[model samples]
Target: MLELTTEQVAALAEIDAKRFVEGVRADLCKDDPKLVDDTTFSSRLWRAFKAAREVGIERDENLVAFLRVEAYAPSFYEQPAIRAWLTRPGRSADQRFHDYLRVVRWHIEHPKFQGGLNNGGSGSAGNRGGSASTWSGLGARWRGFIGRGSGGGSG
Candidate 1:
């Protein structure tokens, strides 16, 4: 059996994270050509990854969901309602992510939730012109990513 040192493990993890970030960057750019011209896009994506990790959403699928949401509504995770939901007890990371998706979807579908009526409407999906097709597209992409991952695991 091959045994790795702590430093080696850390280095490998870093490498994996870097690769993941780059892959996500490429996908984002492909999805939105404008991002390709934005030099700060990479940094923003990296920050989103860090933010997701900070919230215990480290799995690739969950991270993808977070990134998609962040792309649609910048600074979404910082909203009080979203922040509270993320910190709610008794749920695993996957469960929280799924529930968060439901909440976001619900908000998007309801017109009353649009225009900042709730949560100050700052960075809310409604504030970002979140149409049903747009959010449904995001949900479809998230489902695709989740489908490719192992059935269960937090990280």
Candidate 2:
């Protein structure tokens, strides 16, 4: 008799695909260590994102509004493409949501970033074609997110 916690329920209700996939991966990794392999996790994430696409569209207003408001803060956190995509005129919310999904699906299917130390690339720690610093930031953020027990209830 498994049940979703308040945070897990909110993540689903809000269509937080990243959170959902990470949570699922953590849970699966607990049961079977091999289940958290990059390939398996990527596949599971793709499936989860695809299955939840419709829900993402249905609940687009939350993300759309958040991105829109963030755009006004004069900060780098506001992605220009997202702002333009969500705020473009003469388009319905659903249409915008679909367009957003199209971009998301494309990224998920064919990530632009493929060469990394973890991916078995031959780049050294200091020579990643200007991506080393980016990976540093990503590493910290990933460690924090995964270490926070986001896999559901108290763990």
Candidate 3:
């Protein structure tokens, strides 16, 4: 039998977290070259990682999804509706994440939910035009990612 001290455990956890962040950063940069040029990109990704951990979203795939949302809507967690969903009782973090995905999908699918989040009217950190199409693309990518079976983790 082997035993580890608390400090050792914490050190190991830190190392794991750093590796995970680096891996995610590489993947995201590969997905979007623009991030490689953004000076604040690493900081934002670290913040996203912390936010996901705060909300108990430890799974890698879920963390990636959360980061994707953060990339689109910097203030996503601050949105009243999103905050409510996150704090909803009787649900695990994974369940809440999945429900959030559903809401995003529904919003993307419906025409009425189009302009609000994209134009700075709703609780999103609005971007330029073509947000609807961008969100639709994100939804499609998410669908494809999620449909690929449940083998995701820190890799």
Q: What is the TM-score of each candidate against the true structure?
A: 0.66, 0.27, 0.67
lDDT winner, 1 or 2: 1
lDDT per residue for candidate 3 within 67-155, as digits (tens), equals 77655445456556566777678997878988878776765545344555466454342342443445435634344333322265321
Worst 10 residues of 2 by lDDT: 68-77
Q: Using alpha carbons, what is the TM-score of model 2?
A: 0.27
For candidate 1, lDDT tens digit of each residue in 91-148? 8665797787876566545635444565564542334433344644554443333332
RMSD values for the candidates in order, in angstroms, are 10.7, 14.4, 10.6
Backbone Cα, N, C clashes tallied per candidate: 1, 0, 0
> Which residue runs does candidate 1 get wrong by more than 4 Å?
112-155
TM-score of 3: 0.67
The stretch of ten residues in a row with the least summed lDDT in candidate 1 is: 141-150
Quantify all predictions' global Cα lDDT against the true fold: 0.65, 0.42, 0.65
Q: What lDDT score goes with residue 105 in model 2? A: 39
Best by TM-score: 3
